[model samples]
Target: MMKRLKSRLSSIVIAICLPVIVVADPIVGVWKTEPDRKSLISHIKITACGDKFCGRILSAYDASGKEVQTPNIGKKLFWDVVGEGGGKYGGGEFWVPLINVDAVPQMTLQGDKLLVKGCEHAICAHQTWSRL
Candidate 1:
């Protein structure tokens, strides 16, 4: 019947468009990073870049919560990050501003927190960032 054919076509259309409708990844947000060795905190803004994701430092603050001017602001902290499902992401490069080096990065999203880790050879470090 025509009604049955039309219903099947509608189902197919929805199935094809579902992925596009849900294109926004949960990782897209502003996250507050843990204080570094200098006791400075950074707020990173994560956004969609092509099919992957990228994060940049939006601002920085001192230990007393006063916003400070830092050259690292507006710098790309991470890029080419791809979500691997189950709240895990990897395949990205992380920039360590303090050390002026790059490392392989991995991330995991848990509720309002994000665990970001970077490894260079045998050395590894991680920081927990809270969503703001």
Candidate 2:
């Protein structure tokens, strides 16, 4: 009877601890920025940079849909992501080297909308990103 009780207790402990062991999905995939008719171009790609999450230009095209080469390829797009509890990330700036603007970019994934908080140099463009 004591052995059977011990087995049941072990099973209960494992069941209780299983949820804590499950980790959230890592945000290391292609993401597309929300399109804008006013802006000439828009694109986004969230990639893993060391231990941080960084974004890059995945696609930039003119109105004709032709691929355009972006100037900010190797720049640091974002950082300080691990502190935001996995899905929420911030503490970095997003910039376009061709354009003269760098915004304090904070992003959170909710459903299919990646809400981005943009604020830098008096220019803010709140963009919603979609996973690609």
Best by TM-score: 1
Which 10-residue window of candidate 1 scores lowest in summed lDDT? 15-24
Tell me the deviation in Å of residue 45 in model 2: 2.1
Q: Candidate 1, 23: how far from true, in Å?
A: 5.2
- Superposed by TM-score, candidate 2 places the C-alpha of residue 101 at a distance from the truth, in angstroms, of 3.2
Judged by whole-model lDDT over C-alpha atoms, candidate 2 comes out at: 0.63
> Could you list the CA RMSD of all candidates, in the order they appear?
4.3, 7.3
Each model's TM-score? 0.84, 0.61
Worst 10 residues of 2 by lDDT: 18-27
Clashes of 2: 0
Candidate 2 clash pair list: none
Residues 13-128, model 1: lDDT tens digits: 99777545335788889999999999999999998777778999999999999999999999999999989999999998999999999999999999999999999999999999
For each candidate, how many residue pairs have backbone atoms clashing (under 3 Å)?
0, 0
Top lDDT model: 1
